[model samples]
Target: MNETGIPDDPLLLGIDTGGTYTDAVLFCERSGVVAKAKALTTRHDLAEGIAGAVDAVLAKASAPARRIGLVSMSTTLATNALVEGQGGRVALVMIGFSETDLTQAGLRNALRSDPVLFLPGGHDVHGNETPLEMERLEAEIAALAQDVTAFAVCAYFAVRNPAHEIAVRDFIRARTDLPVTMSHELSAQLGGPRRALTTLLNARLIALIDRLVLASDRFLETRGIRAPLMVVRGDGALVSAEFARRRPIETILSGPAASLVGARYLTGLDRAIVSDIGGTTTDIAVLENGQPRIDPQGASVGGHRTMVEALAMRTFGLGGDSEVTIEEGGLSGRIVLGPRRLVPLSLAAHLHGGRIVEALQKQETRPVPSRLNGRFACLSGMPARHATGLSKSEAALYARLGPEPVALDALILSSAQLAPLDRLVARGLVSLIGFTPSDAAHVLGRQTGWDAEAARLGAALFARRRDGAGQQLATDAEAFCERVMARLARRSAEAVLETALCEDGLDGAALAGHELMRRALDGEQSVTRLRVSLDRPVIGLGASAPLHYAGLGALLRGDCVLPEDADVANAIGAVVGRVGVRSEAHIGQPQEGVYRVQVAEELRDFPDEEEALAFAESVLMRDLHDRARQAGADQAELHVTRDIRAVDVDGSRRFLEARVVAQASGRPRMTLNHD
Candidate 1:
């Protein structure tokens, strides 16, 4: 048995649901990975893909369902949704704030027409309460409940005292069935607008994460795997599925964090730059002394900076399935890859074989290529109910779309139709299918498992497009495919370098594109030869890492390590991770000799500074220990740290404030025997 007292080789199942694929791995601590499998992710019904991968892995390992002791999963679904600006609508309730406050922290931009209400309620820095006005909320609760999937409550200075926020949350729960997220529950920091923004996002993701957890639970039950299901948080720590459902915003970098953990475990690397290339986004982070760095400023995804504590990772929108576009009005016709993803033509043809092939073949035979030669649109398989809030134009365009792919040239006869089509795509009701890096890989034979014929045809169509100089973009299909692959490599290198430069406190974005940096990357020779390189190797992880990162080492002037089973690293990390929880309390002096201690929704006054500090630490430890258990830890060990602030006045020390933090960490509880 291991030190935790469980069996040494208990079989564990790990699952990772990503933008394009769902992967599963069966692992044993004593034996390492037993079996691994992958399946195309089905967004409409995630269970389909989950079952496909899990069943495949189980069959490959020759293991019965009941033998599994634990099941853990990590996902990029929440991250992708925010990056793509797709989620259920939500209502924001801000107490003790005005319309002017929404302008802070990009909160107004993030709201984007979603309902927001401001009321008179809040607390001071020393936990003094402000009268809460809830008459307006009570009157409009029923109407708001009908329009939004969830609600977010943020009382000004809620971190000082959560009484107002809790009161509003309870009121909402008593009136409506929708989930309500309180800002204080998300963060104890004193930034009201930022905390509210975080709570707003968490509210938006409630239904999405809940659906995934519910689906996973039902699927596992059907398979007779009665193991405790855990979820990987953005910090690479494990938490109960229920915990994740309430705070899905914390899962923004879940998949990338898991990949970092898996990379460290697989390569045993002390320090390396890890880049994980997935279909929708490429996640990059650094491992310092075998640990991923935590972002003290909170995680940022899409364009909104949030208050979610996640790994210090940069997510770029350049990946295998990134949309391939040619820069307009440029004589050289330089290619541009996405900040947006597309369903690759190869995968489309593989799924809808004859029809996809016929469409591409017909497009290839055209005398002159149109701008929309190889583009198609189809339903994204989201349920019809989610198609609400569409404009008349959007509804009309959405009506014409069905399960089958429709060529954009035929579907969009006028330029006016383009905007509606884009709106539909943004709403997640439709997906655009086009030639992407994945199709380029297929054409060049660097990747497989999809229709190469469709890729070749799509490449041919793209090659025939004209540049500003009236010359063809490429001589032939293979040449165009090669150029596409080369661009992907160059972009991937820049992404890695940009991340490294940022970590060193430089302007990574601007420097990565600077002429000197460009020359260094391209190995340009001149009278003044320049060179730049990384101090350590780069660990590349992803299904297509081998193909995409083949030349990354030479470009970066460093070694690139591609470990075995790197493709399923996220899943592996999910199973091997431990559960960790943290709680904090603060002691602030409202006046001389009066210490006000605030922790876990309670505030009390103490005459002595030492007494207040002791009370804060005790409260923090008790709260964190219970939280650790609820987060899935079997038996957590607790640690406390103190940060006291004071100033010397007249050669005597005066107390200002004290912050006490408690941390609990332990392995997840595993089943000892089949029930």
Candidate 2:
């Protein structure tokens, strides 16, 4: 309200980059969404997709870039990295950890042949430790630095006191130019191996997240949109881009969390089950009391559990681009969706023009369908260095492949060559293009963004496939496509019910596959009638939610809410959240009246418990306040909570330990134009 009581425009731009598409929306405080736009995600150069979406949204809203006061983004890049098992290779440095500890928390499996260095220095439960053997680290530091892109340091009982981990981090920093992640910085939990695993993951993600942030920043600057950039955390909270760059592990579920936030805001529902389907995964979570349920056990992504607080989401690798495969060994063959995403044949055709269609048509001329009738393989957008560990056979086959899609039937010379190709696909160096739900949608006329003729040909090839009893699966291409859609629907319903049953304290897999539950879900008619339903409504979110979740209501026996602007829900959620920063301090009593408080990096002893607690709280509050402000929050509000553990001894309470947590939260500050 300058001189005439008129409020200046304060527009906000939100962007979400998923595995398949990038969505953008323009929003305002006075009004809701002004406009929304989408573009295909370009893996080779993400900034291209960001520019396309942002430019289109701005043009649609007819708003000047200068009027945009804030720009925030959410992405599945970290989550996808975990799922696809692709990231910068890093070495894990373990202090005082035995080989047996590797078996705990799937640490050994997560390491997956990565270099691990074990040393003989760490603290005990009381944060009392032996002196670190700096000479041991020094001997191997130079050689290890050359092989790994980053380093993860974790010492036993580092949460109680991170002195050893800090020393190792400094040691590595001075020796190498690589980034180093300390376990204590990621989590204050007591589990050493789990914390190490989390630290390793964070170290792996540093480069990926940094690239995304830099790309977004560059695009914003290029467009002359000089707003403060923000990034969403896994718990549906906002943080500054700089903060996110440091702790990218907190963003593993950033996109799904944003969808949940968007779901609640769009439907105004206090309690419901929110399910968001993307190209690679289907994320399902419960919303209670207008907030998403937080997982007490930390977030588990791609089978690895990290100490990052996130929504209690059950994610299944079932989505639009999920690779379609036939269930083996059954006379009546069944279709199965994926744990891996594949480019649809129709999409491949559209991308490569007539080459893809010519190959498919040429294969159709055969008397019978080959094993790889509708499958093709191509190199993904990874760098050449990523193809380092290929075996002789794998290397020979890979060398023959070019950038264009090659029909699998034409590429694989013998049966033994198939395994090598699968390995390449698993390594993310290559992608297998095949029949998927998206191709089925194109065949059934439900989608039209790609080549429909190629979809029809692919569907015809799949329809020609024989079951164990040697019978045609479908009468025609359209019928076969319908079966694909039905298979996806049934699997999706099971995924939802499985999650619900788990929440109800039942074995999700067993209950979901039980005969009784199956009858109830299908509404079967028999002498014994059974009915199963969800207690809360189901909120569907995603670009294809309306198309895929149309029958979800009947399956769950609840109202299926698909709010308007569902396609851009993640983008909307990215902008509507407030910035939050939390800090904690642990206070313990080492002896009678001798209190020790673990501050940021050091432990100090005080004469009494009150003095220690006060000092710790003051430090934490000041640190959290500064962080929240630096995280783009203005006029932040601070709250403090203390969890003091004590037991009644005779007549008085005996103090054991105390944890002080400080949280600072505020709406993001908007940049005003100075014209």
Q: State the RMSD for candidate 1.
A: 2.8
Clash count, one per candidate: 0, 0
lDDT of 1 at 233: 92
TM-score for each of the candidates: 0.95, 0.94
lDDT of each: 0.91, 0.88
Report the C-alpha displacement of residue 39, candidate 1, in angstroms: 1.0
- Which portions of model 1 show Cα errors greater than 4 Å? 1-8, 84-91, 112-115, 137-148, 174-177
Question: Per-residue lDDT of 123-200 in model 2, one digit per residue for the tens?
Answer: 877778967776767888898888898999999988888999988988888888999999988888889989999999
Q: How far off is residue 133 in model 2, in Å?
A: 3.6
For candidate 1, write residues 332-451 as lDDT tens digits: 989999978999999999999788889889988889898888899999999999898899999999999999999999899899999999989887899999999999999988899999
Candidate 1 TM-score, true structure as reference? 0.95
